[model samples]
Target: MSLKSTVIFLLSLITVMAKAQIDTAKIKSYADQVMVRVNIDTNIERYVFTEGPEDKPLETILSINNKTRASFSVDYKIISGTVSFTPNFLPGNNDNELKGSSSYADFRFRFFPKKIIQTVYYKKVKGFYIENMQDFFPEWKEGKDAYLQFPDLKIQSFGGSTAYVMKKDFSLKSIYTQGEWQKESRGSWVPVIDYDLSIFTDIIDGRKNRDTQYSIGASMGYFYNWVLGKKNRVNIAPNVGLGLGGMFSSTRDILDDGTKSSKENTQYLTIRFATGLHIGYNTDRLLFGGKFNVTSSAYNEKGNQNVQNNNLYGLIYIGYRFPPPGVVKRNYDKIQKKIPIL
Candidate 1:
C-alpha cells in the first residue's frame, strides 16, 4: 500500500475502536451499576452511577446540586449496598404523595446552611414600667402611707446586636443599648430632712431628673424555621431567648441639706426573657427580614430598696443577611446531634 493509504487505514481503525468503547459504555446493565434513587411526591428520579466509592462529601455535592434545581428536599438512606435519597425533590413536575397539615410542604426543599452565619441588627425599644409608683417611694405618702399616685414613666432606647449562629438551630448574641426616660407630667417627690423633720420635697419644677441608662447583655437561643413557597423563597423563624446582665444609670437623689443632690451613678442587676418573631424573603445570596420581639426584665430597684423594678420592652427591627463562607459548611445530616462551643 502507498504511504497516504496506510495512514488513512490507521486513522479509520482508531475511529472504529473509539466508537466501540462509547457503545460499550452506553449499554452497561442497570444491575451492574450502583444507583441514587430519589422519590418525591410519588415520582421517582434515579441517578445511575459510574465509578469510585458511593460516599461523597454532602456539602460540596449539595452546593453543586443546588445550582441547577431551585426547589428540592434531602433525605438519604443506604440499604443493602444501595445509596438512595428517599423522598428527594426535583424541579419539574413530580407526583404529590404525602398529604397532611404541616410546615413540611413549606420546607419541601430543605436548604439548610452548614456555615457560620453572622448577623448585625439594629433595634428600637420602647420600655414600659410595670411597678406601681407607690412601690417606688412609700415615704412620700402623707400620714397613713396610703397610695401616692405618680405618672407612668416612659423609656425610649435604641441598640445594636451582633449574633453568631453556631449551628442550624442555635445561636449566641451580644447587645449594647442606651436610653433616657421621657419627662413625666408631674415632678417626683422626695422625703427630705428639714429642721430635723422629714417633709415632702419636689425634685423638679415640673418633670424630675430624666434618668439616663446604658446596658450590655449576652443571650443565647434556638430557632425553629419554616420555609414557605413552592420555590422556598420565603422563610419564617420564631425564637425564644433568656438573658442576664446589668444596667448602669445616673440618677437623682436627695442630700441631708434637703436640696437636690448631684446625679449618682448606680448599677442594677437585670434578668431578661425575650421572644422574637422573624418574617422574611431570601434568595441564595441575599436575605431581608423584619423582626419583632418582646423582652421583660426584673431589676433591683434603687428608689425603694424593698421593691423591684418590673420593666417590659417591645422592640422592632429590620435587617438583611449576606452570603456566608463555604469553607465552614458541614453536612448536618451526619452531625445534627453534635454540640459546639458557643
Candidate 2:
C-alpha cells in the first residue's frame, strides 16, 4: 500500500522469479568444473509388478514415484558391487549370468546385500568439447578424457517385490472352476472353491464405477482356477476369481418402458470381497489371473448398511497379474553387463 512497502514487495518478487528461472546451461558456467566416472552404464531400465481384474488391462502397478514396473532382482560379484535390475529385461537375470562364470559367489542376489562403490571411473573414448560441456550440457563434464563420468547416485541398483491386483477382468463362465497348476499337483484345480464370490456388473465399469453406484458395501468368498498340463507349455493357466461384494442398484427410476418400475434402485452401501485364480501362460514374467467370488454389502433406501444374509454375494477384485501378451522379447544385453552393443 505505501511507496516503500510496494518497492520492497516488487524487489522480492523479482528475486524469487530470477531464482526460479535458473537453468542447466547457467549452472554449467562454473569457475571450477570437476567430473567423476564409474565403470558401468549409468542409465538402466526399471520395472515393477502389477495386478489386474477381469475387465481392465493388467498393468505393472506403479509405486509412489509413478512408474510402471515388471520384476526386480539383484546382481553381485566378488569385487564388483551390487545393482538391481528387472528380471523381465534379461533371461537368467544378473544372478544367472554371474553363476555361469564364477566358481562360487559369496552372496546370493536374493539376500539383497548393500555394497555399492563410490567415485569409480570409465574408459575414456570420445566426448564433446569442454567449452561445449561448460556452455551447453553441464551434466556431461565428469570425464577427464573422452569418456565423461555419469552423475553419481546413492542408490546403486533396485531390487524388491510387489503385489498387484487384476485390472483387465473376466466374467463368470461356469459356477465351478478346476484345472492343474504348473507348480501344483497334476490334477484338477480345486473345483467349487466354496464361498466363491462373483461380481455381476457390466464389463464397462470404471471409478471402480463412480457416479454409477450408490454407497455400496461388498465382501468376497471362495475361488478356483483352471491350470493346464505340460502340453500347454508346462504351465499354461486360465484363471477364475471368486469373491463377493455389494453395489447399490440405483437405477429404479421410471424406465423407458414406463412400467413405473421402482426396481431395487435403492441407495445401498458397497462392500465386496473376491477370490481369483491366475494362470501362467508365458516364459516371460507375466500372470493372467481372474476372480469369481461374491460381494455382499448393501444399503437401504437411505444409503445405510444392508448386507444380505445369504452367502451368495457379487464378487469384486484387485490384482497384479495379466495374460501373456503373445510374445515378449528380453534385452539380453541389459541383463548381462558383458553386454553386446546392438
Candidate 3:
C-alpha cells in the first residue's frame, strides 16, 4: 500500500479501538498536573559496514566522539515534548583532537490519545571516526594512534511512529513518560507502524555527494510492567519488537570533472529490531528512573555489502509534578476547546 493509505488506515484503526473501556482501578492518571524532567543519557549512534565472505568478513564501525547528552522534557495532559543536545563539558565527550569534532541534536514530541500512542522526532548528527582502528591497522594503539575521521559527513533524519495497546489494563505511559502509574503488574502486545526519511551528505576529494532514504515498517511488540514495593512505587518494564521493511534510496555524486551523476529509487530489504528495559520509582509528586534501550536496522546492497545502523543508550532521569498555574491551565483549556486533541 502507499504510505498515505497506510497512515490513514492506522489512524482509523486507532480511533475505532480507542472507544473501548479501560480499567481505571489498575492505573493512575496525572493529567491534572504538569511534569518537568531533566535527563542525563549516554546515547551513541553508530554505523557498521561489512563485506566479503560469511566465514571471514571485513568490517568498519563509524561513530561520533560525543558520549554524553542532556535533555529537558515537559508533559501536560496528553502532550509531551523533549529537547536534547550533546554536552561537550562532560568527561569523555570532548576528545576532538583524535576523533575530530562532532555535533548532535534531537527534538521529540509525543501524544497519548486513549490507547494509542503517537510520536514524532527529528535528529541531526555530524562527524564520525572509525572506532575500531586496530582492525585495519595492525600496529595501531588505542591512545597513541588516531583513527580515520569523516568530519564532513552529516546525517539528518525525520521519523514517527503510531502504536496501539491491545490490553485495557496495561499502561505504556507509566513506563515511557511517567505520565501515569500502574498499580498492578500487567503485560500487553502492541502493534506499531513507523516511518522515516533520512538524508546523508559527505565530501570526498573536494566533491560533495548526497544520499536520501525512505523506509516504513510494521512491528509487533510485547511489553510487561512489573510493579513492586508495598506502595506500588517501584516498577520494572521490559519490551521487545521485531519488524521487516523496505528502503528506497537515491544517490547523487559529483564526478571528477564537476558533473553530477544521479542514481534514483534503488530498493533494498530491511530488518529491524528493538528492545528496552525501564526501572523507576514513582509517587504523586516525584519520580526518578533509569532505562536502557537498543535499536538496530540492517540492509544488504549489491556485491554482498551489508550496512547496519545501531543505536544504544542508557538514561537516568528525575522529575517533579506540580499543579499548573491558573493562566497556563486557562490558556491550555482555550486551545483545547478549538483542537479537542490537546
Going through the candidates in order, what is the number of backbone clashes in each? Answer: 2, 97, 0
Give a tens-digit lDDT track for model 2, residues 1-342: 863564355445434433433222110111011111111111112122223433642323111111112322221211122222222343322332211111111111211112111112111111111122333344544334232111111111112211121211211111111111233212112222122112222112111111224222222222222224654323322222223334444433333454544445433333332322233332222223322222222223342222232122121112222232233213332443563221
Candidate 1 has its poorest 10 consecutive residues by lDDT at 173-182
Prediction 3 TM-score vs. true: 0.92
lDDT of 1 by residue, 64-134 (tens): 11111122212221111111122224442222221111111111111112222222222221111111334
Query: Where in model 1 is the C-alpha error above 4 Å?
Result: 1-158, 168-208, 253-260, 280-292, 302-342
Question: Superposing all C-alpha atoms, what RMSD in Å does each candidate have to the true structure?
Answer: 31.5, 30.3, 7.2
Q: How would the candidate models be sorted by lDDT, starting from the highest?
A: 3, 1, 2
Whole-model lDDT values for every prediction: 0.32, 0.24, 0.89
Clashing pairs in 1: 41-95, 72-109
Once superposed on the true structure, which residue ranges of model 3 sit more than 4 Å away at CA?
1-25, 255-259
- True-structure lDDT of candidate 3: 0.89
Residue-level lDDT of model 3, residues 30-53, one tens digit each, is: 988999999999988999999999
Q: Which ten residues in a row have the lowest lDDT in candidate 3?
A: 13-22
